[model samples]
Target chain A: MTPLPRWADVVLLPLLNVVLAFLVGGLIVLAVGQNPLQAVGIMLYGAFGYGSGFGYTLYYTTDFIFAGLAVSLAYHAGLFNIGPEGQAYVGGLGVILLGLALNGAHWAIVFPLMIICGGAFGALWAFVPGYLQAKRGSHVVITTILFNFIATSMMGFLISRVLKPVGVNSDESAPLEAITRVPQLRTFIELFKNSPVNLTFFLAIIALFFIYWLIWRTKFGYAVRALGQNPVAANYAGISNQKMIMIVMAMSGVLAAMVAVNNVGGVQGRLILNFVNGAGFVGIAVAFMGRGHPVGVGLSALLFGILYQGGQELAFQMPGITREMIVTIQALVILFTGAMGDMLRAPLARLLARSSSPTGAK
Target chain B: MESYLVDITLILDSTVRLAVPLILACLAGLYSERAGIVDIGLEGKLLAGAFAAASMSAVTGSAWLGLLAGIGAALMFSGIHGLASINFKGNQTISGVALNFLAAGLTTFLGQSWFKRGGYTPQLSGDQRFNPITLPFAEQLREVPILGQIYFELISGHNIITYFAFIAVPVTAWVLFRTRFGLRLRAVGENPKAIDTAGISVTRLRYQALIITAVLVGIGGAYLSIAQSAGFNNNMSAGRGYIALAALIFAKWRPGPALLVCLMFGFLDAVQFRIQGQVFPIIGEVPVQAIQALPYILTVILLAGFIGRAVAPKASGIPYTKER
Candidate 1:
């Protein structure tokens, strides 16, 4: 098979896949007796036409960026960290516990401590599965999935029975003090009015750059890439595959923990049941769609954020279309970009080879 | 003593009911995995089947038609999985995950659009559902002795799907060990290259295996909406597909042991429901979530080889290429 050019592999292929996914999504909208073009218009308008909508889009994008980075880091280490959902859930415990402990502390002090505490907890949660896969030969995919269920059960018990304040009917912790919570961007920027976009959004941007550097520009990154490509070769080169797996998984968990910071610390101001709300799962699609590149992840995360914010508006305005339509589109994106990613490769390679051969002959 | 016996019987009865879907889905996974295709989308298939079955039954008012629709929906999902993994040589796990999300989203999206009842089908009854069937002499034997109560309560009244699930174990064992098709399926899973060398098409065998898997899981899904309950609710499969996957691993891909593991998990579920909010001696109230999480926890332990190693088929999760 002819290899694709780097540009085609990195950018063109992903764009094609996204286009295919949306085309199919449009067909689904048509099947449901709605005008596909109209639906697209509504989605685009909802996502970017107004200031607050764009703010919400960015807020959602922040969560996806962290989650996507988490998956991408582990992917670079040849690990599928499917337990981001679980890790993020457990990470909330850390954020909430610290927030409650320093009830009225300044936001500047509480925010950093919350990140450290939450990242540590999430890393610990992910580290166990990594250790199992590394030492005990358990497959990380299955263990991580089971861990998601366990985390759900454990968190449900804790939130409802242990953490819920007396006389409170809902399963949530006490609200953090206003001064202690991460300040929303709207406080400083007039354009992001009434939006939950916050300091964590900036953290997400920094994390993306940090991941790009850590995955490409460092010795550890070389080892991770080597391990991912071929474990036996990496082992022969004196890189401990076991150690790499555990560390990469922990790093992935730390990235995933940022979702908790975005939601619990930035937006909700309290730990609530199911606060993650499928954002971690959304990360899977984003990571795959991005092809594990920071730039790609950023763009795909923003795309999903648009779909999410827009889909809500679409559901409200268009009675026929529902919010789940976005999930279907996400599924299609994963299908095209991740699972059956190479379905078009043969034809694409042939076409490129045919077209380039004539040009290169000169 | 009598009340305790009655309580035990009731729990066992519910256990049988609950285990039926797990049993079917586990067997479905058994067929697919035995043919070297990892199906993580079993949960999605179950949910799709449930929605299809409920919707079809509501429309046609025929339980049998609902079963067919359920099977058809699962088969469609299996086809997508096959197209991606078998034909396209894509990542099997990713394909499965995609199918699951697709089923979840499409089911609800379509359900709410068509039914307008918040992702639920209309409540089914009468001929639209597979109601419980009382075995011969069950009512007559109710008045007899302790044996009569056991027969009447525990062994007599279940829908056809439950009976089929129990019967499927032996049938699967026979088909796997006694038939040439089964031998080819197992060979395809263990070493597709060898089967390919033996003048048998590995792809055909795998597709066949997947077809059987779809049929079984579809029946399980139908049983959920049409037999066990009245209609399909949102996410009604409720992770039974995953629980079945766990049972499949726990059983180490054997049908007989798969049944036992599913039953054990079902027993845990029944006990969980029974003991919820109930105070017990010494331990006080056992949190329902603990028991709910027990199967997953145990499977993790088993997978980690704390009890024993649960080895999968050699060729599972790898896309087979001619050169490879």
Candidate 2:
């Protein structure tokens, strides 16, 4: 296949999206009278260059990976899966309960079991919308949005009412015992003279590889992709469209659960309100930004994690810029990359189609 | 028995107040989606309008002027949404979600930075408040047994906006069915290609409809801020926008049904508020969370085939494209 033309194969689309986002982001900075170059530099350094900052970035990215994966799985089955936020919380509850309720079992056995429980619970939550979409033809967007509020409020109810921290008046769960805990890597960064990245970072990469194999190297993958492209055609091709959608949604649920299990169990180790903090929504941005590719999703998640960490740091250092600026930047990035990018995608797709047609046919 | 009667009256009055904003916002949503645009940003637009109205009213000492400012700002925001989604033919849902996120961040930032408040704008006094109109025979009516409280409380004594919200229902019905512009608007929504062939501009009609919805939603937001609480706070609109969308779906996008749907949801919310201390006295302190979650849970149930399956406008949430 005489090496696919570089521009048509790669360079243009993702590059164009990044450039467009930056330019729009730059205009926003200018509007606020901040030097675009310096702000960008500061954001980068604040996220990665500092000792503590990069640690938080890695920690944050771990959650993002789950979110990105969740969105991508749903996207593969032609479902938006907007309920990741809800699924993540349910997963968070599952892991937290497991951690608290279980005694001092062996680490290997207990940890894996909790993770599976978290994923299964999360997946079950996601399946409701998927089932509705496939069977009743309900719009996934409205259904999922509805579930998010229910999940958040229900979790809050349990945490504050039934699962309140022992010997405390406040609305919080008791922190997990050390035997059931994820060992802190923050100290290991100094002790081992290594980066602040945790064991979860390695686990995330492994998960991504597994996702890639599941998506590309499996028969299920073919069914999902086919369903996404055209469910009617996929049905004609002897694939069960409804089954494929349910499976994909289940996969998304597990991915969303990983965020909750890993974040709550491996990092925070307690149930908290708003703790998911729009990561699910950001995952939608990442899924579209990455064009539903694993590697692309990983990179976008890292970039977002960096920005998030930096945004927190900037709030502390500047005193002038508020913590909400981070959210503004996030919104603007999503706007340019998601909606505005579509405005440009059609033209680029046309150009690629034209250039690659006859030559590519050969 | 008298106490029970007072409780019923209070609950009735609360339902009307609760339903007015939902009715208005749902009507706004009906117009936009009917014209082939999805509006997930109603919550955000309402937030921006609420904040603007509250701040403007507090500063200028004129509630009416604040309402005008709120409408103007919302129209401009909706115009941005239309330009991005309709003209540029971008993804409508993404644009709407982005607008919400932007509003969430921007308003909070400004509220804390400028106002030096706890993400809340200052409260306004009676001078900037709207008065409700009570029934004329209320003195004689409350003593008139069965229909007494209903006539005095539920049927009457609602603010001007509540009356307007109910009237707007028929006006929307008439505009949608009788008027030439409304027919063309529906045509653009249902089948833009047909409208394009019939010498109508799809882009223009959509933008016009969105802007009109924006104005109505702006009034709804003003009612939320000044009329609901007589002030504003960051994120005060909460999830009212989503609830309205739920009502719109539950209503199946028609005004007559939309009004009833809003009232039903409003009733649910009002009952939840009233019962937190009675039925769930043990969970009495949980009112804030319970009430907050009520609308969303109802929405999910409705979507899951409780009330009915709601089919949206056929061409909704799709960006219209034309050949160059």
Candidate 3:
């Protein structure tokens, strides 16, 4: 059979899967005796209707973008790194420590330092699992999953026992000094007035470009892709499997950890328990749906950002659509885009092949 | 001395209870993975089972019927995973992860709308839940010292599902070793082509393995909602599935070793539950987080080859094709 066009293979298949997923979500809403059309409209309005709503969407988008990039980069090296959630949690601790230690420092200095510390901590956390997988033959998936739980427990300890404000009686660090907080997008730009969307949104955009170069344009990127495609062949061609594994995992960890900067420095300006939530896990689906491409990751992240913001709005506006409904919608998207992607891709490929064939016959 | 004895009994009792779910899930993974299907969606299956059992029991007021419903829901999910990974040649890991997201999202959404209690099912009551079962003469034997304590508290008083979990370990070992189906299942996992050439259907064997896994995982999940607790709360499985996966690895994917590993992990969980803010001699008030993180740390250590190798089935995670 003739191969489907690159555009169709990369874009069309996922787009169709996404549409079908939303359709299934609509049917689910209908089953619950709600108007699917009305629900969709409400979500759209909630996500994009107002300045704050849009800002929140972008804010969430930044988190997903970082996580999606993290997973996507790891995918390039044939590693399924599910440790981003853990990495981000550890990174938050680094950000919290840096913020507390540098309280009263200029934002110019504190901001960069926070990024560095977050990246370092996240990389450190991921390093052991990567090292184990590469050298000891441990399965990355299980190791990364175990690390997530470890990270959660570690974060709980640090926040409550050591990092807790003297008398707060809560499992959270003290609010960062105002000078250490990054400006919200509204303050930074007049067009985004009254929104919580912050400077990290632009940072995420820059990250998108950087990841694109890292994955597609560089020698290191070529090695990573080669390792992913054929590790034995890559090793034969002079790429060290051990070194690639470590570098890819470290890079993935750094990207995952950067979400701490967005949440800690930009949005909340304080370290709170579970601030990363499930965004890192959601990155797995984002990368899968995006087909491990930067542009695809960016687009899927934006879509998730809308769903998160709009789902909340939908719940508030129409009480029938509960917050959990949004989670179901997200699941449906994951199911279609990741698990059952072939439902669309296979048939579409066959159809495309048939149409493109010279004889137009089987 | 008596207080120490009481504390030991309490922790052991909790370990037995907590280990029930882990044991069942571990056995489920054993069947699926031994058949060459890496069932990472055990967590998703458990959550789905919990939600189904809790909601059904709440509606029908029959814990038995709730169990059936839970198994049914889990089977449907396993079928989806099988079809995707086996038939469609999709990435099994991705499918499993997607199944997890699906279960987490759908159960909460449906639970919220049906019961309107913030994504929790209505609480089960009386006959609607699986009450603890006392073995014959357990209370009469309570005065018999250590033997009495072990019989009554540690072994006898658990819910029926817990007893089944204990029984399941030996039964699984028997099925995997003594039965022809077990031999075929292991062969399919190791080399599907050989199984196919031997006049056996590889797809059928794998599907059957997954179905068994679904049933066992379903029971494990149902036990959590109906027996361990009164009803299902959102995300109630609480990563026990992953811990079971860790236990599976810790046991090197063998059924007999898996039981011990699960119990060990359960003991860690029990410690976590009981050891909060307790002062130890050297550590000086051990953090709850450290206790909670122990199982994962142990898993990392084992996987790092500090212990013997944990090898998977030769053909595990690779989709089988007719030609190759």
Q: Which candidate tops DockQ? A: 1
| TM-score of predicted chain B versus true chain B for each candidate | 0.99, 0.91, 0.98
- Per-residue lDDT of model 3, residues A1-362, tens digit only: 45668899777988998888889988988998889899878888988998888888998899999999999999989999988999998999888889888988877788888889989999988887889889998988889999999999988888887777787976788888788877787875676676778877888899999989987899999999999999999999999999999888988999999899999887788889999999898788788778788889999899889889988898888777777666666667677777778776667878887667777655
- Using DockQ as the yardstick, the better of models 1 and 3 is 1
In CAPRI terms, model 2 is classed as medium
Candidates sorted by TM-score, best first:
1, 3, 2
lDDT of 2 by residue, B3-80 (tens): 888887787789889998899899999999999999998988888888888878888888888788778768877987
Model 3 CAPRI rating: medium
Decreasing lDDT order of the candidates: 1, 3, 2
Q: Which one wins on lDDT?
A: 1
Q: Give stretches of model 1 more than 4 Å off.
A: none
lDDT of 1 by residue, B1-324 (tens): 989999999999999999999999999999999999999999999999999999999999999999999999999999999999999999998898888889888999899889989889999999999988999999999988689999999899899999999999999999999999999989999999999999998888899999999999999999999999999998899889999999999999999999999999999999998998899999999999999999999999999999998999999988888874
Give lDDT tens digits, candidate 3, residues B197-232: 998888999999999999999999999999999999
**Cα lDDT over the full model 2:** 0.79
Candidate with maximal TM-score: 1
Clashing pairs for predicted structure model 1, backbone only: none
